[model samples]
Target: MLRTTLVAAMLLATTPAFAQPEPARVEVNGMHMYYEVSGEGPPLIVLHGAYMNIETMGAIIPALAESHTVYALELQGHGRTTDIDRPITYQNLADDVAGFMEAVGIGKASVFGYSMGANAGLQMVIRHPEKVDRAVLASVAYDAKGWQPEFLAFLPQLAPEFFVGTPVEDEYRRLAANPEGFPALVDKLIALEHEPLAWEADVAKIETPILIVQGDADTPSPEHAVAMLRLLGGGTMGDMGAPLPASRLAILPGTSHTALMNQPELLKALIGPFLRGETPKGMFD
Candidate 1:
């Protein structure tokens, strides 16, 4: 009996400290939302790019979980969440996200998203600002015009074949209820991207402080990003006598959209302060 107890202790001590429990599933708005909640501070919600799910941000989520109750979710039709016939619109997705928060009992949280997730984050701020404390919108624009001509042209090129044998497909198949429906999900996102989407006027209504993260060569030109800031009362020249705009913008040099998600350490360093309601100094470099 003593030897058995000693063996169990050895096994327990060797287990990794940072290992997170498996995601828990909850039904919200008729969709099964699979989310992993970790850490024990203020809540931070994470949304991933289109055609991808929570795992796409895998590298970054753990670091964020260090100081936050990271509510990383698989949106409807993404990852383990089965799709409904309602179609995949940003507005509907935002509603789903809002409902998820209510079901999980989170009041207001620091919402952060990348690519499709970023767009969804903006939609959340628009449709459900009451539930959002701070927001991070990365690698996205407010409307069709915000995306550059070349990037706009690149949307149709995102065929299912492009993701075959990649991590995106592997992760999708691993957790998706219907792995065969991956192509259809890709089609829906492409069609949505092609459709004329405009919300620049809505930007003025978003009173929530937002941190805009974009790569210098991202799909939306830096000028378009600046325009977003202007609407958020950021681009105007405020004197040292006054407070800086609640909205903060970061345009990382030599960074591409693909490179952005891959650099969790860099993102953590830059975003840590903003999440805490502090301005990040010298992020342009």
Candidate 2:
């Protein structure tokens, strides 16, 4: 028995420290939320995109965990926090995030959100301004409607056979298998057809330091980015000498919509320092 115990101890000691299990689930506004907390320092909350979970930010979590305490959450109806009954809207999602932080006893935290997650971050900053110290919205658009055109355009490019054979098909099959809940799930996606968050007014109210990161190659068009920059009151343009703020735009060269996952160096360089309160080198040139 002593030898067995010794072996167990050895295995535990050899395990990578960063591979620790995620924290226990906690109730947030009557919903069970799964979250992982790590590192020690100022708190940073990461919100993942639609149809994704906390693990979607897996690429940068290790780097972020090195200096800041990272809180990664699985949003309602996604990942492990399934069976959500609430109507899906940016505000509802934001409230869920705020409630999650409150349940965890964190009064304020810096927020980093990607894609649909960025919309939630914006809503959080708007509704719970006091709870957000700083915010980073990566690969976001000024209008929620901006997603419709691209999705419609891309859907045709992907063969129906591809959708049928892909792993995502399994998720679709699973949802369809649920006779009782499948209708509601379909309704939710239908509601998302008309994204409710419009930027013209909300952009004016944001007072927190905002970082907008986009890849020149990833964005289907420059119009959305241009609109976002204009609404943010502009910043020092990068090598272009344009009026856009250097702080507002981190345009990665030759990257696509999912650049954050593919370009670690660029993401680390842009996000690491912004989170540390240091300006990235050459950001304003």
Those runs of model 1 whose alpha carbons end farther than 4 Å from true positions after fitting are 1-18, 156-167, 280-285
User: How accurate locally is residue 182 in candidate 1, as Cα lDDT from 0 to 100?
Assistant: 75
lDDT of each: 0.76, 0.63
Q: Candidate 2 lDDT (Cα, whole model)?
A: 0.63
TM-score of each: 0.87, 0.77
- lDDT (tens digit, per residue) of candidate 2 on 1-285: 001111112222221224453666888766678788877789999887654555545556666777788898877665566546677777787899899888889999999887667778888888999999888887776565444365545433433243233333343334232324434543564465355547668877677777887667543245666667667766544566554343366676775565444555567677777776774356555
Error of 2 at 50 (Å): 1.6
Give model 1's TM-score versus the native structure: 0.87
Model 1 agreement with the true structure over 66-180: per-residue lDDT tens digits? 8888888888788788877666878888898999999989888989888778888999999999999999888867877776687656555556576556655666688789888
* Alpha-carbon RMSD, each predicted model: 10.1, 10.2
